[model samples]
Target: MKSAELNYPTQQQELLAIVHALAAFRMYYLDEPPIVETDHKSLEGLFTQKMANRRLARWYDILAEYQPTFPICPERRTASLMH
Candidate 1:
């Protein structure tokens, strides 16, 4: 279950990736909370944001169904590890 979406804001793209991953693997990890690791640290505050934006609100609603723990993955560290 791999995917890519074009022409979205950086935040939206990050959220989309989480949505896709959860949808793809929901059956295996539905009962257990999923650990979502990413370089996007701002995502840690996603649910706390004011949902004035409809798109973000909808995305938040979609995400509320699962228990997700976001672990910060520093971009520099990830890039270095990939080398």
Candidate 2:
């Protein structure tokens, strides 16, 4: 399943909401690790960089806590889904 959102000023908020939705899905259905597919490169970059604005930084920490060893693959400008 994929969640696609428009790139608006509230992009960060939208992404966080999507993350929560995915987490809920994981808890209710899939017990195994789930690879969340996102088109937002900044979202992936934020997690990969491991830093962000005050509020986003907190979420980043929480996300990092969940999957302590997830991989961050860099994608080319023309590629969809980094790597």
Candidate 3:
């Protein structure tokens, strides 16, 4: 899905993307801890953020179930691929 199509805030949008991708491929990665690679380094500290809203808190809880690992990748190196 396109980011423009999502009405959520930028941070929420990022989290939603991860959630959607994981849900769509749950069968293939459910049994194993999935490695989530992203150009957005902020995602690596997503759960550590002090969520001021319930929505973000809820999203954090949902993510806890997957036990995902976020590896920091330089955006410039992955810029073209992101497009």
Candidate 4:
């Protein structure tokens, strides 16, 4: 990660990964609603509501095109999930 990107919070990185994946698999996402399964519970709210972080806000705009659904698994908790 570049120095400019090193300061992003955990949630921001998670969202970044999602954005990258969406862009990488644009063809597949274009046809159907992508399901993003993550342990980060906050991501649901991050995308659903307005984001304060400029970086996140930008990624949110990118995500709007995919119209993905975050069905965060109830079984896996963020604290317990290992990086």
Candidate 5:
């Protein structure tokens, strides 16, 4: 994590991981909105709820391009992988 990123809240850090992964392989996911599996309990609300953080705003802007879906997978099923 970058020095500045260390200051981000846990939720933002989790979202950052998603954004970074998506940006890294955008081409393969462009045709279809990728399904991200995680146990992040608020994954659903993360995209729907409003937030005031600038980092989240920027990350959402980047994520908007893919419109990624974050599924609430069971802990055993969620290995931080895309399905």
Candidate 6:
């Protein structure tokens, strides 16, 4: 497997990028479903919840574009890896 690094100015943008990155990673690397590791657990809930903001709505639309079927798992022990 390969990994990529991304930088964002805001937490919200970073979260959206993470969802995009994980979907890309799964499409490029795994044949079976892949589990994404994220530092923010709130994003897991946010992705499933209805969007209230325009930016969030746009981000959600980008996330939905991937048709991602994999699950997202919050980092259990090493949270600094992504940062």
Top of the candidates by lDDT: 5
TM-score of each: 0.79, 0.48, 0.78, 0.77, 0.79, 0.51
Residues 16-76, candidate 4: write the lDDT tens digits.
8788989999998767899988877887677667668677778878988889988887754
Q: After superposition, how far is residue 42 of candidate 6 from its true place, in Å?
A: 1.0
Model 2: per-residue lDDT, tens digit, 1-83? 22443343355765577567656765653445555554455665555564546767766665654553333345554285335
Return the candidate ranking by lDDT, descending: 5, 4, 1, 3, 6, 2
- Among all windows of 10 consecutive residues in model 2, the one with the lowest summed lDDT is 1-10
Stretches of candidate 3 off by over 4 Å are: 1-5
On residues 1-83, what C-alpha lDDT tens digit does candidate 6 reach at each position? 12333343345655666666766675564454444555655665666777767868876676555555535555655566546
lDDT of 1 at 45: 73
Kindly provide the TM-score of model 5 when superposed on the true structure, using C-alpha atoms.
0.79
* Candidate 5, 22-77: lDDT as tens digits: 98999899789998777888666777878777767888898888987776878756
Q: Indicate the residue-level lDDT of 20 in model 6.
A: 62
lDDT of 4 at 60: 74
- Specify the poorest-scoring 10-residue window by lDDT in model 5: 74-83
* Model 6 lDDT-worst window of ten: 1-10
Better of 1 and 2 by lDDT: 1
lDDT of model 6, residue 48 = 70
Q: What is the C-alpha lDDT of each candidate?
A: 0.79, 0.55, 0.78, 0.79, 0.81, 0.58
